[model samples]
Target: MLVRMGKNWEISEEISKLQGKIRNLLKETGWSVKDFADKYFWEELDSDGAYGDEDDKSRHAEKVKKHLSSSSSTAKRLELLKKYVEFIETSRLYRKDVMPLRRETASGMQDAGFKAAMRKLSSELNELLLKKS
Candidate 1:
């Protein structure tokens, strides 16, 4: 799967281990299920231009609400998901795949200060989790 992203066709044991770690992190952080689908909606919008069109955004937002009603409504959910994925992807503590996504999302934020602020939130959340253990 990583190979599809780039030219490094070689799959190392270390990379496999890292993949496992990322999967575990996703599960532990409650990011693995469809229940968290709204999270992906905003991230996709930020990273892939998936929701750039108003029609697409509205449809995706409806899907988000259908999947995660607790965070219902397209606009509010997009805002929340953007905030959450931004924090998670930008923080140094998250895995490498997160960085590319973070950089993409930062494009929307535009301001370095806002991006940094989101990163700080991410770092704080990571710290809090570490301390809990």
Candidate 2:
């Protein structure tokens, strides 16, 4: 069974709750912070957004690794988690799609595409916010 984190009520609260759940998950699963970041962060993050260059992204990932490795307080970890959630969400929301502007395009294709993308992102977010029990 998986231990789910969010109440699906409010984004802020849900994210906060998720961070704590993630901390426990890390402890229980014997996964390093780097493992978690590699599994959940790099793939979804937009390098063209807040993380402009590959180097910048690498540095940020290192920062997360160090932060988690330290004896940081629980409050600090939760705060960092909220920021990470925000970074991914903001990048995805503002990312410029490469869709070609064609006058002959189908009427609802763009909308359908957007819906599909959102569904995929939501599913990924669920994996991050859930812990295997």
Candidate 3:
């Protein structure tokens, strides 16, 4: 029924809304994080001693990636998160008692640019489907 279809669309819309927030958060904070990493890496290298060309953003970005990546293992972070979640879920009715908080899935949140592409594709497909019918 049309009502069920609308209800189903609600989840996708929620996903889209959450995806938009994630994309914005990543866009804003990724730069801030990288900037912090870039400074830290630069300082570490400079203290240990050397100067790369001042104009090269690529060089700085690379150093940030290298150092930021080496700073923590994803496996360890995930392991900690798993234990934390288990503790929260089992030891207390944490999420059940809390007010609803919107969040994206850890692995599946997509950037809005991709969502725009998907919308474009969906529009084209809808047009084609209508013609075929």
Best candidate according to TM-score: 2
Q: List the residue pairs that clash in candidate 3.
A: none
TM-score of each: 0.27, 0.32, 0.22
Task: Please give the CA lDDT of all the candidate structures.
Answer: 0.48, 0.52, 0.44
List, residue by residue over 24-85, the lDDT tens digit for candidate 2: 65554455566556534555565336555768666766877665445443555656776654
For residue 129, give model 1's deviation from the true position in Å: 15
Better of 2 and 3 by TM-score: 2
* Model 2, residue 89: C-alpha shift (Å): 14
Q: Give a tens-digit lDDT track for model 1, residues 38-99.
A: 45554545466645665665676566445333423344444454454454444333544433
Better of 1 and 3 by TM-score: 1
What RMSD does model 3 have? 23.1
Model 1 regions lying over 4 Å from their true place: 1-10, 33-41, 47-133
Clashes of each: 0, 0, 0
Error of 3 at 29 (Å): 9.1
RMSD to the native, candidate 1?
Answer: 16.7
TM-score of 3: 0.22
